[model samples]
Target: MIKWIIFDAMGVIFIVGDDTNDLLVPFIQGHNKRILKKTINEVYLRASLGQITSRQFWQEVGLGAQYPQIETVYLDTQLILDDGFTSVARMMSKQYSLALLSNDVSEWSAYLRNRFAMDFLDVFVISGDIHCRKPDLNIYKRFLKEAGTQAGECVFIDDRCKNLAVAKSMGFKTIYFVRQPKKSDFVPDASITSFNELENAIENICQQIIERVIFY
Candidate 1:
């Protein structure tokens, strides 16, 4: 029986807009834009792993001098909540253990926790905090340990196929969040585009589990 519901933060729980570059480009646009972009991409993984501080990341990206301005611009550009997901999460928290597993930085994660009241969550396995990111088996195993649940006893939800694939392989029931279905070898147990659909999908999964237990 599934006792925990694990969610991915960025694309699933929060909308970081269509492109993150849209948020940062305005603050650091110049002839060195391409160079700065390359630098950011190179350091992003390291930064997310907490190998470097948030201040160091901004500095490496050439926005160190305008850190405050760039930070405001980035925050203003993205919507924190992904519409109905917050309500769904709140409702689900009452019945099952809730966890957040995300490839996130420390500063933004701290800001998010402060901006939103997510006290219902039983575990928050952030990449920066753990020094590991999803798609890495160790991270998923870490989540399982921290969440205090076996992989088979949790439902993992993510917008990325690669992340879901890893969870599915590790015995988690997977849910894929996408608007349009695409051809992929990695198939999710459930696919949902909107939060309304997600609620129904989870309900159906739980019902199936109950039915199986009763039948056996």
Candidate 2:
């Protein structure tokens, strides 16, 4: 049976999953017309990997002296919680341990969690804190270490299939989260278009696990 439920921060908990595409890219484009999206992406990745400080990220991205504004004007004002997720999570928390696995800047992750009041989470393995990002294998290892559970006992939910690919390889049961369903080549153990559907999908996975153990 799954004991821990690990959710990705961006898309899973927050409404915007791909912050580079949804939040950062547009912010950069609007603020600095000369910086290419490629530069923004690379610098962002460095920040997420803990290779650079949050202040340095802004400076490198041509937003020097703007980290304070960013916390207020950008992330604080823009990042939104997924509607109805907190309620569902409260109910689910009684049944399973909830944790977070995210690729985010260290300071940004903490601020976001505090802003949204994610007190329900017990473990948070953030890339910015650990110097490793998803799909690299080490990040997931860090999660398992921090969570004190094996991959099989955890259910990881993410909006990005590539991150899920690595988790699946590591023996994690994955649920793909999408705002809306579309034809996709990649498949996960379950899929949900909305947060309200999560409990049912998790229950279904648990049931399957029980049945498999019975059969064995």
Candidate 2 worst ten-residue window by lDDT: 178-187
The lowest-lDDT stretch of 10 consecutive residues in candidate 1 is 17-26
Residues 48-86 of candidate 2 have per-residue lDDT tens digits of 999998889888988886767865678766788888889
lDDT of 1 by residue, 138-200 (tens): 999999888778998999988889999999999998999884466789988898888888778
Q: Can you tell me which runs of candidate 1 are displaced by over 4 Å?
A: 16-34, 211-216
Candidate lDDT (C-alpha), each:
0.79, 0.88
For all predictions, the C-alpha RMSD in Å is 2.5, 1.5
Candidate 2 segments whose C-alpha is farther than 4 A from its true place: 180-184
Q: Give the TM-score comparing model 1 with the true structure, all chains together.
A: 0.88
Best by lDDT: 2
**TM-scores of the models, in the given order?**
0.88, 0.94
Pairs with steric clashes in candidate 1: none
Candidate with the greatest TM-score versus the true structure:
2
